[model samples]
Target: MSFLKEISEYKDTIINRLLSDQELCKAVYYADEGFLEKPDIDDLDNLIYENIFPHRFIPDTTETAKTFVTISCTDYRPTGNSFKNGLLNIYMFTHRDLFRTDYGYTRMDFIMTKIEELMNSKRGIGLGELGFGGLNEYVVNEKFQGYVLSYRPVDFNR
Candidate 1:
């Protein structure tokens, strides 16, 4: 398979894993404040689904509050003539107010942990097992704060 196809399939896999977890979905709904207006369960699901992006998050001026995730690849290169290696990055963004609670632990901590559980060591079509790389803080537009989790293919020989 082509690299693009592999990436696309992997993205879909990630989305499916995330959406299938009820606990994670509930946390995401609360973090996004979906309960404030008493939205339907379908609405919550739609909101969560819409927030996830394949490559990048297109900024929207009309959105006053948002939480989202972006899946991207970096350092892509051919290895040993037939294999490919790269890093897959998952970025989670949310408003600063929802980023951390007063007790020092952040609200996103559970979300990130859940994602790690779902993705780490997972294998995708045309790719090797994903190994956890690292996690770090990331800020966007002075209003959003979150974490970026990186993963690398274990063998890159698929």
Candidate 2:
């Protein structure tokens, strides 16, 4: 497959895995408003699905609150013959207040853990199993405080 196809497929896999987890969905919903009752599962799923971006996060001025993820292939290289390796960066963003709020430790914590559980070591099209590298704090504009989780192919020889 072409490199573009590989990256696209990898991103789709990540988004699908995230949306499939009910607990993660609930955590996202509660992240903004801890006191609000849970909404329907489908609604939560839609909310997450809509927020996930493939290569970029286009901030909407109309949005008063935002929580989202942006998936990007930041680096890639061919190992020789047909083999390849790359680094994938997944950025999880939430409102600064929501991220810092103490709702039994905050929902960003749960979201990050769930993302790691779903994505780490997962295989993708034209790529080896994903090995989580590390996570670092990322500031997305003034309203958002986020983390960037890095992943790379585990076995480059494949």
Q: Which residue segments of model 1 deviate by more than 4 Å?
A: 32-40, 43-45, 61-63, 100-104, 125-128, 154-158
lDDT of 2 by residue, 8-91 (tens): 777777778877887676666555555235664765446644667777675672466767777888668777876677788888
lDDT for 108 in candidate 1 is 71
Candidate 1 clashing pairs?
Answer: none
Local accuracy of candidate 1 as per-residue lDDT tens digits, 29-53:
6654332333435543474446777
Among all candidates shown, the one with the greatest lDDT = 2
Q: Which candidate comes out best when scored by TM-score?
A: 2
Residue pairs clashing in model 2 are none
The per-prediction tally of clashing pairs is 0, 0
